[model samples]
Target: MDDHTALIRATLDHIHQGVCIFNKENRLVGWNQQVANMLSLKLTQFRVGADFDFLFRRLQDELRIQSGTSPASVLAWVEDRGPRPPLRFEVRQRQGRVFDIFAQEMPDRGFVISFTDVTAERRAAAALRAANDLLEARVEARTAEIAVALADAERANASKSRFVAAASHDLLQPLSAAKLYCASLADDTLAPAQTEILSKALNALNSVEDIIGALMDISQLETGNAPVRVGAVDLGRVLRQLGDELHPAARAKGLDLRIRPSHALVQTDASYLRRILQNLIGNAIRYTRTGRVLVGTRTDGDALRIEVWDTGPGIPLAEHENIYKEFHRIDPAANTGNGLGLGLAIVERACALLDHPHGMHTRLGRGTCFHLTVPRAGLPPRDAALPAPEPGTDLAGLIVLLVEADSQTRRALSGLMERWGVEVLDVASGTEAAALLAEIDLVPDAMLIDAPVDDGHAGLALIARLRAQFGQVPCRMLTADCTPGLGADCVLMDVSLLLEPVDPAALAFFLASARVSG
Candidate 1:
């Protein structure tokens, strides 16, 4: 062979793939040793004068026919003798070996074919497909498990909310009775030492009541049960009421409680807004030893910023984020107030429900200012403030109907009303109360019905019946249920709602007002 021909032959033999060449007459012109090895053919079979069709027939006999290709189809393709386009296909030998075959027609109407071992590539592809299927199956199983776990967690949370409500209702019944008994005793003349003991006892009871209330609030807010009624709320009136209520506690601590007057109307849930400010102002007054607690409102762009500023020991930087967590306290040793550390948690949740943004600013050793922004509504009505009943108002000569399920609470409350010179007709159920009133043929000046009276029917239903029977008498519904829609129901029925444990002062005010109106 010439130098160039020798070099070409050497290159073709060195290649990994089998190589073969054909001449115009369809006779073998060139060949590589790899072609013989890949096709399992003897080197002696590779003669220069060998026909391409004969070589292909020999290869077909040595290899298994591909799935969709028949011996007839192969014979037709070989006999056509026409120019063929480049073709590629995979085939397997009967001995379980895979090969890739390629054929390309030369310009002279002859064709060359090559073979390459592909057994390892096919095995690796199959293994990869199996691994992918396994991974997909595992992912699907895990996803199903997570879905079931999440459903279980949600059910547990709902159950927890129901349990808390039931337990609080049961607990508050006795607690209200205790508080009423204490109030009754306080009215009796006693020795100086006995009076002090009674005062401390009342304080202890009040602390317990506060803790229970905080727990109930936290439960409602956390479990998404606290109902929000957004409307135009008179901000000034709420602040004034809170100021009047908390003034005594502030004065007792020698702190100035300043509530700047504002007539701004805002869109929010009145009850929640009141509670948020109540907790913030109360917290300020509690933490502040001898400084002023200021509450006021200022106008932002389209919102009102209500702020509660206090001159007290500022919170540490590290404790800022933690203050909103349940039962988390800063300087617990120094906190002497009746707080369960749930105040801020309630504020945070309530604000989130209302979509109100609340934040705080503080400086160590100076004080802290907590503020919340609320969307402002139009001008408030001309008369926003209702006349508050005078403190220590008398309820004497008032015939009040008390429908309490618990006997202890009924007796205790009756004694308290009697001590206040009021006549109380106490019954354990709505049926008894109605029957007693009918027997006596007497119309009470006011009614105090425990919500969900002993028979498990709502007090509002009873109130409606009583009003229908005996003209619209001033009515109040005493309840331990803080569920949503209770307040709206009471409002629609024109009955006041006093949540248990009922404050003696609030109960007295309702009776005094009812007596006066009657």
Candidate 2:
């Protein structure tokens, strides 16, 4: 060989990558030292002029190379490899090392093969996979912990709701009794000055009750305790009752409580609708000093628009958005008679819960109008032949069974019943009533049962016992606030319910109606 050829051979010996060349006659012509090291070939058998097949068989057997087949099969594959394009392949040795091999045909018709070690790349990929597995495990554990914390928070909120609900009744019982006593006292013969003083006291008592009741409702609604029940609601009946209840107060203020007659029924939660209208109308009455507060309705496409128009100090455009926020008022310093400013907040929440659209339109000092759009009920129109309840029913000489737990409530109720000339048997519990029933010769014509009595079941138990013995006597269940479940129980018992602080006149009317129905 020439000197240049010898120098090239020396350079190939010092190269890092394994390289081998075969002549056109398919004999091994040259190879670097790296080829022998990489394949673990015996240098004695890897001589120049060795047949390419011999060299290939020696490398394959020594390195335990895997070609997805046996050594004989690989030899056959190598024999069939004629003139072809360049090719690349990967292989793993028995010693757990990896390699990338490249083979190409030279321009002179000789073949060259080269190999590179890739074992480190494979090890790095393995470490990355282990890290990914650890990360996934930690994420799953954190998700489980968050779910447990969420459940704990929900349970705590429910417990708080129950405590508030029970406390509302206890708080209102005394207020209800005092209101009843005031009403009974107003009926007595007294001087004009004494009568006027008693009237102011009654007004003060009513304002206190209104504040307490509004707070309880707002608390229940905000805490997600009040369940939303959507159904067809008789807006006409609700408006009429609301107007009747608040008419006395409006007249006392010398403002007109005008409720236009409407036969429109709408799709909404009936109780929630009542509350919304109650707040709006109550605000109208409380704010308006001289003019009128009109509760009216009109049809707007497939919706019924119920509007409360009041001749009161109108809301400013800037304050309109802020009005629905909790404890917000247009005139903060003005004495608007015991308003905590939660009325419109309750209205806004009720609208959102029902998915109903609501807005207000007002002009400075002309009047303010608040309206809500309720979806028109799809049911057929109400039958015109349906009869209304007979009013002004007399209660003289009617025997009434009254079950009340509070001492003041019992005395106030007894006094009201006596004033109406109705015979009342007032007891603190169902057990006492049963014992009294055994002793009394006269049977009760109707029952007025106080709900959520001792153990939360006494009122219901008494009703069932009375029904079993008396056979469907007309009964009225009285409560501070009638919860949804208790309302369902009242329906099942086929009885009427009166929420406190109950109006004495309303109670007397209910008792008289019960006597007539019995």
Candidate 3:
């Protein structure tokens, strides 16, 4: 062979795929040893002048023509010189091996064919498909398990909420009775030691009541059972009300509770906003041993920032996030009161539900300030202020119709009201109260009814009936059931709501207002 031909043959021999060329006369012109090896042909049989038809026939007979074309048709297809795209196909040998074949027509009517061994590649692709299938199956099974577990957890949470509702109501009944009795006893003359003992007893009862209230609030917030009625709320009025309600407690602690007044109306759920601020201020008061707790508001670019500041041992940086967690105390040893540490938890959840952004700023020992941002809803009405009953106001000659199912609570409340110079017509049920009122033919100046009198329906019905009968008597509904919609119901019925165990100062203020209105 000449040098050029020898060089071309040497280059073809180095190629990984089998390479072969055929002329227009269908005779082989060039080929590599790989062509002979891939086709299972002897070197003598694969001569340079060999006919392409003979090699194709041999391959067809040996490999069983897996492409589903007969040898005659394939030979005819190869003999044709029509212009077309490159033909690519796969063939499997009888020995279970696979090969990829490529045939490209040259410009001179001849063709170049290549054979590539794809047996390992096919096996690997099959293995990969199987592995992917197995992985997808495992993922599907795990997803199903997670869905079931989530459903179970949701059911358990709902059950716990129901239990909390029932247990709180049951517990608060006697707690209210005990507090009322202690309050009544405080009015009587006693020695200094006896009075101190009585005060401590009342403090302990108050602690229990606070813990229960916190738990109930947390449960309502977590279970999404706290109703949110968003509207334009009088910020000044709410602040003033809270200040009036909490002022006594702060004074008792010897802490100055300063509430800065503002007539800015805010767009928010009034009930939730009130509860959130109540918890913040109450928490501040609880932790603060000395100094002052201040509540105020400021305008902040279409939003109102309501802040509660306290002069107590501030939260540590490490415990900042933990403060919102249930039952997590900053300094457990220093906390002497019976608190479950649920105040901030409730506040957090309530704020989240209201979509109001809340946060805190703190110093280690000086103090801490908790703030919430709410959207501004313009100014309140010019005459938004009503004269609030003054502190230490008396309810003497105020006839209060008290309808409570629990006998002890009824008796204790009656005694406490009587001590305050109010005439109390206390009864165990709405039926008894109505019957007693009918028999005496006397209209009470106000009505204080337990919300759960006959599964929370009778008390509401009794209020409606009495208002229809007596013409617009001021009514207050007391309840330990912190269920959703209770406040809305009270509002719709135009009655005040007092959550138990009721604060004595708040109850006294209500009675004093009733006396004034009467």
Candidate 4:
């Protein structure tokens, strides 16, 4: 090597910045001895061709974006971007501390860039940045807290949102149970006046559920937890199912429901897709009293464009974008048993999860169209179709033990059982039911235990309790909570569950089905 080359290499080696020399072809030509030291490179075994991906990633994470960007690209632009600052980039290999990265073009043949371990300098800068970030974060958090505190005065409203979001699960648990109990009451056959009182109770329960669920949806979207499960789906089938489910509701509300299917397959989660359509159509039915809800689909290159159109009180053009925001309800006091204004927010979040593009087109008082384009779902899974539950036999001349807490509920439920022509023995508490089980020689054909459960979640301990007592006795939970993650628990315990305040018809059907399966 020439004298200048040797000097450059030696001088660059003593510098404190991570440096490398690259040729015009953007290949690493040479690097100073410091690069090896900082990267934990052993002098005896040095590699000159390795990429700078790690170096840049460390920089990016450290917020040394400018410093990090040059690892792959040449630093020639540093000339115009101002004097290259000694940037604090993290050394991923050692991960000891951040380091300052300094670089300059070579004066001679190729280039000679060296690195000096400036971990201390980096740490110092990072410490400062972290302190600032922490301070900023605290400020943000405090600001939110204040917003919640003064929510009535319009100040704490924002912070109240954050606080509510954090404590939602705890707040919603009891409310969910109460709702289930209310539904159970509604499911009971009573005089018309009594039923009217129960209907009011059901409506109140629904409102609480809507608010809690909406808040949870907002939190999930904001926190990026609502991940999309990409899979192959039949879009036509999804539309049809949505139509079947919502058409009646729409018609009941004097709204038209139309599903225009396109013969396109999607590689996305069918559940998420269905949720999207349901939210859209449900909103249409809620807002448009005498209009139409139309769902249409098309193909655009590699994307599947799904559209939800509604002839409702069309959104004001200026407010279209804002409607996707959290709690952006146009009719705040409609009280139509519709959910918290979380539908659009959830749709927005779902779109993000799917990496889909969503847009809104509205003609005030005319109609509104929401369009989202998603990449097609992949090929169908081999295990797409899970077999339905085996139909069980009729419980002819059989006795059933309705083991549950809540005295009034037990009586109402007993009446339901009596109506089914099955002998029913209702108890005030689960303990009473247990006592009966201990005394009775012939165990009831099946037990419908309104059993209290551990964890205070939606699931029941009844599944395990019954399975332990009488294997395959067909125990199902009559719970009100509608959360996921129950199927696994049911499978593990070999139990079946039906949501609470079970419809007598559906319940009877389930009982006969359980008998057949047994």
Global lDDT scores for all candidate models: 0.81, 0.76, 0.82, 0.59
Which regions of candidate 1 deviate over 4 angstroms? Answer: 1-5, 22-29, 45-85, 92-97, 220-274, 288-294, 310-319, 362-367, 377-383, 429-447, 453-457, 460-476, 484-497, 512-518
- Looking at model 3, residue 158 earns an lDDT score of 81
Best by lDDT: 3
Model 1, 156-258: lDDT tens digits are: 8778877887888888888998889988888889999999998898788778877887887888787774667887777776775566557666766889888
Candidate 4's C-alpha lDDT? 0.59
Tens digit of lDDT per residue, candidate 3, span 378-441? 6664744446566677778888999887888888889999999999898887788879999999
Compute the lDDT of residue 9 as modeled in candidate 4: 76
- The TM-scores of all predictions, comma-separated, are 0.81, 0.72, 0.82, 0.46
Candidate ordering by lDDT (highest first):
3, 1, 2, 4
CA lDDT, candidate 1, residue 413: 85
Higher-scoring candidate on TM-score, 3 or 4? 3
Worst-scoring 10-residue span by lDDT in model 2: 380-389
Of 1 and 2, the candidate ranking higher by TM-score: 1
Tens-place lDDT digits, model 2, residues 1-518: 69988897898888888888877777788888887787776677677888877776555644554455455654444454566577566677777787877777777777788888878987798888988888888888888998898788778777766676677777779888988898998889989999999988887877777777777777777777677777666666666556545665776688877888777778877767877888999888888877999989888999999999999888888998999998887886664577778889989987887888999999888889999999988664463321222445677888989988888989998997898898989998888888898897567988888887334456777799878987778677778664544544453355556667777755765565566556
Candidate 1, 470: how far from true, in Å? 7.0
Task: List model 4 lDDT by residue over 1-518, tens digit each.
Answer: 69988898788777666577654333465666666666665665445664344333433553333345544344444323333333333333335544444444444333334445556666688899999999999999999998776565443444454465446544544554555455456656789999988878766765665566566556545644334456556766566445544555565577767788555667666656666776777777777756688888777888888888888778875676778877677766753665667888888787777677888888877888888887775543242321223324345665776765545556666666665577876765556766777887556666676534333232356445655776667565544332223423442344444434343434565566455545
How many clashing residue pairs appear in each of the predictions shown?
0, 0, 0, 22
For model 2 the TM-score comes to 0.72
Query: Residue 378 CA error for candidate 4 (Å)?
Result: 4.6
